[model samples]
Target: MTVATDTPLVDTHFHLYTRDMPITSWAWHHPPEDASAEQFLALMDQHGVGYGVVAAASLYGQYNDYVIRCCRKYPRLRGTAFVRPDTDMYTLERMKADGIVGIRLFFRRVPDPPDLNSPEYKLLLRRVRDLDWHVHTLVSSPALPEVIRAVEEAGVKLVIDHFGKPDERLGVDCPGFKALLAAVERGRTWVKLSAGFRMPSREAARSYAQALLRVSGGERLMWGSDWPFAAFESGVTYGQTIADLHDWVPDAATRRLITADTPMRLYFGA
Candidate 1:
């Protein structure tokens, strides 16, 4: 499908995985086929995306060697990895030097979320801040307020994944979503206009995106395909994923901001 925006697109979230990579845990019964860097780049080319950020898959835990390798291999690609609070500053500095622009915190499927208020977590955030990296989180809506408060208090730039993974039934009325809006107003947080299927209905997804547009405008919002779509891969197609942006963000100017300008600034520093 042809993208309507004049500006080049950048997918702010995608993943790369191979069978050879060890899996500590998985969101589903393992993907039927590998989603490799080579395939990701081909998809980008097919869809007119000039740049991408390869977010570390939680299934691989903290084994970021492959992603680091991809970043080094492709200048147009950047990455984020799953990291523990105890991860030392030296390693973080090394990762940043290797083109990792952010650190991901996955709280959605875990039994308990990290204690963001703890000293260890605070120290990690401080180190991340010092290195000029942002915190990318995939968290449930109910936990967003605390996470938002903690990230803001730590003075780290925040990127919320998949529309804060809001409850589709509640849409904008969800308390977690309300907190997301408030966080955007604070000026340090960026929300992805992505993973529309995560919401209950297409209408709900559009409502949430429109809510963000009205409150935060395009500056604090970006677009992502969630490529290879993990467990949902069978049902969703890359073309449809790119096409959804047109539906959710109808205005060309706003679409440009989300698809190109905002992402370039956030992930590529362009």
Candidate 2:
């Protein structure tokens, strides 16, 4: 778990939801788990992650206070939120003050939260754009195209979580995944090369990460540990996740671009 000083990197897809947050009440069926800020920071220190993006989890519903507090504690960290349609510009501006860089729509195993093209959703995106906040989508592979089109047309930068949740059974070149790459190439889109197990490679999941890197220009991709790797308790490890990056991306410079430069540009604008 010793992270060499020279290669210190940012974890772009970490989550934070405390046990007190009524996590079980939310529609997302995952049981409540304790993931405190202090524990998270310690883990980052152990693993050599210099910073992290504490994205809002669906289990928290509209509550973002915990994630906001983490950002306040560490200047190097930032966050994303789960917001509703009627969220006003004033509210978004306040969240901006609180160190939130974007608003997320988490759609994992559940139904899509809201139609991206709906009036409420459109207005939310427009306001998010006005505040210059990016839109984070934690959706399945099948919903990527529609969400991508909606966010892009709204002129807000979009982030795709879990490498499109691609169907590993179909291989990387599957038509739906191809569309995801096309969207990234078109600009205005960013993909997180996280969640290797969710991808369809029964043998070695690393190939799934490689497929995303092949299509997503290094500048448009970000790396994350997806820490506390829920449901992957037995096999996942921080070292293994970082090592997988090697297979998916072969060059040192490209790895730096995806892990460091891209995240800095998007989250910190450095």
Candidate 3:
């Protein structure tokens, strides 16, 4: 069936992994089924989604071979890479040439994030800036202030994953959520409207979305399905993700901007 909004959607967040890849020792959330680019694209195609931005999975650490392979093979896909902070410009340039548009910072699970002010990370962010790439991050709300400051200070575009992952108990009133809105106001950060099912409830997701729409004023915002559902896969479907977007933002015009115009121009330039 066609998407109700009839927009050629762009998914800005999703992952691709295979069991054969070298998983990191500290990996979390091992779904028995692999979420491959082919499978995800098939679902996208079925749902009228024209393009997607494949997020780098932290579960595999710096083993980005599969993501690189998929981006190279499918022009419809762009991706992020997870690499060591000390990785040089040459490798980063190579990754850019392979259709990777950004670097990913997976810090939600890390008790102590890497020092973004340190020499190694500073250089890495600088190199990423030179490529005109963004630093996509999955950081908890409490840790957001430091990360936001460091990334924005580096003059790189920052995309926060899963609606800035605000603390459930605090919701919109939380400092992290407020920090996100402030960053959005500065015009360098974009929040991924994704993974609503991961929220404490549908009402919480709706409240967060409404707050973001108010703060962003309909810019620097895009929608994603968080496809394959990963840790929360058992009861969800891609179609429902689309339906959720409709429910969250009832206006067709606003949805057109979120699901199509913004993301298509941002990722695929279509």
Candidate 4:
């Protein structure tokens, strides 16, 4: 399952968190060790990853100072930040100028997910669209329909985190996954083949990955290491995550599309 390609690989999703950073809220247990940008970049170099996108962690809530700083410090890195719905356009502009390409909506463990149909939320989406930014979403299967409709209506490019997080028991046939496939077909949406460990089982992960490839093709798909592995860190390693991509997508050409070509277009605008 080795892929030989000249195009540099880009990890489309990862996070950078330091203990010193303020934690306004957390989804689960706080990471035992700091996953600094320096450590993340070193992992990328060690694994030959050329560039990466630093997804804003939910633990840090609306505090994006660390992620913004990393994007400014590292020329090869881009970032997404967590911003409140009432976040000023001028402040968003400042974040954009600092190398933030998107904003994250964390719906998984948060007590209250924003109401997409609300005026403020819709206005935020409009601003994001105007700024030429995408929305990175993390939600469970049941929440996908509302998320998809809102994002589509807003006409914003969307990136779904963690394979659309379909229910493990239902696999690709899950209603939410079906909606995701349709969204991919409509264009302006991309899915990350990442955090496979988050899926219920390896078999379910493989099924969902293959279904995405069959329905949406490699052009709309991307790969990510989910570096530092979050809650699964003790069991999942960077090398293992990269290898999982090889197992899920065995074709070298398609692998190139996911690992380098598509990500370059999506994150680096190459």
Candidate 5:
């Protein structure tokens, strides 16, 4: 099912990068081809989505030039970037002016990224806070709680990626999952309802969505397709992703809050 709202929908997460773009040596997976901005926008058009946030792919590391260019060229889109802890404030201000709204921190299966409490990170995160940008993170399990605490304590808004990337067997009881819920109940945390296709079980989507709705009551939640589907590209389709969301939430009005109101306000300043 496609998004049903006539109110222009907001895709809160997705990536746009060409195969020729520079990638980090440690990138877990590399795209075989481009997920160009034009292609992504066309999919949004087909599904009635009007605004989108390009999540900087961990594979591309800090090669944010392409994404920054796309955001500048297309006013309807905004982006997040991956940056070194020592990246300067002037560059960040320029990125923000170019429609880059936040930073993407990927800790999912990453053996070690960086210590947020380090002197370098402390300075970077402070700049993030002062600029009013959220830390869009992909972290799971044991690392999730620590990442959550560090980012929150630093006073930066946090947006959890992929249903908190919870372990299938633990369901909601996972310590990280528990911490995520607690974060929502207590702090400036938002969760994206996306990538259920990557969840261990299809039903996990409905269950996780219920858990978030109970606490957020729909305000701190947003929806995304995780478009191009990343490594799962071959198996999952864009329409199927939206249909999965329809099944998980079912209520059109609440879906509007996720697909329309919350994301539109957060990413687009609408």
Candidate 6:
């Protein structure tokens, strides 16, 4: 698996956790996994990834020292936080200064969005918007349309995880998946073509990813590892997952756009 010199892979999602934070009861499927900052950098070197966004996994709650430590260790990498609604704007500004790009809802583990439209959460989102940060969601595919509409209307860019978590049970044409396709056309919404194993099947993931590329126009799409490749563990390595993306979005240019160009433009202003 050789990556083209110009290919420029950017892993949009990965995790690091510290034990001092109370374990989230919601992350039951994947047993706790640990990877030091150096180990993660070495993994990227081995796989030819130029950059990786260390998204805060739910298990770490709001204690973000491990991820902050990672960014300090590797200035090339950026991070996102799992924040509480009451967190003040200054703290969020501090995180942005520390290479934090956005806040993640981690919606898969916590499906409900805590009413971002409510007075309190709305204020939180508004503060986040003022900083030019994005809101990343791990919502299921079926619920994406509503979530996307709400987030976009709130005036923030959205990053949807796992190809909208398309229900292989219902197939790609499912209303929710179609809704995601339509949403991507709006430009404010972006989707990560990561976690093939979590999809019902590789074939389904391929179909879903190709469909996304067609409508997303490459600019609104990004790639991720979802590394440690949690829950669906079948001895797959991060490299293999990176390699598998060729099957999902075949056009070499679109591949570059999704894996490198789009993420660079959105996350790093490259």
TM-score of each: 0.95, 0.91, 0.96, 0.96, 0.95, 0.92
Write one digit per residue (lDDT tens) for candidate 1, span 1-270.
Answer: 556554347888889989788887545447779999999899888777899898889888878999999998899899999888999988888888788999999886665568899998999999989988999998888889999999999999999988887865677998999999999998999999889976788888888889999997777999888988887988998778777888887888888888888888877778
Q: Tens-digit lDDT track for model 6 on 1-270?
A: 554334447989887664455666665554455655677788888767888898778765677877876786678889898788889988888888888999888656564446666787788788889999999878777777777877888899888888888776787888888988887887788998888877777788888887887787677988888877666546677766776787776678988888888898888889
Error of 4 at 147 (Å): 0.8
After superposing candidate 3, which stretches have Cα over 4 Å from the reference? 1-3
Model 2 lDDT per residue over 157-241, tens place: 9888877776655757566677788888888888888777555563345665666666764779888878767767566877767
Compared with the true structure, model 6 gives a TM-score of: 0.92
| Number of the candidate with higher lDDT, 1 or 5 | 5
What is the C-alpha local distance difference test score of each model? 0.86, 0.77, 0.87, 0.88, 0.87, 0.79
Predicted candidate 2, C-alpha RMSD: 2.5
- Can you write out model 3's per-residue Cα lDDT over 1-270, one digit (the tens) per residue? 235655436888888888788877777777788888889989988998888999998888889999999999999899999888989889889988889999998886654467899999999999989998999998878989999999999999999988898999999999999999999999999888899999999999989999999987668888889988988788888888888787777778888888778877666656
**Model 5, span 1-270: residue lDDT tens:** 555344338888899999988887888888877999999989889878889999999888779999999999999999999888888999999999999999988876455677887999989999999999999998767688899889988999999888898877898889989999999998599999999988888878889999998988887888889988888889898788778888777778888898888887778878
Residue pair clashes in candidate 4: none
Q: Predicted candidate 5: what Cα RMSD to the true structure? A: 1.7
Return the lDDT, model 2, position 48. 76
C-alpha lDDT of candidate 5 relative to the true structure: 0.87
Report the number of the highest-lDDT candidate.
Answer: 4
Candidate 4 lDDT, 1-270, residue by residue in tens: 344233338998899999888886545768889999999889889878899999899888888998899999898999999888999999999998888999999887788888999999999999999999999998789889889999999999999989999987788888999999999999988999999988888888898899999987787999888888888879988887887888788888898888888878877789
The TM-score, computed over Cα atoms with residue i paired to residue i, of candidate 5 is: 0.95
Superior by lDDT: candidate 5 or candidate 6: 5
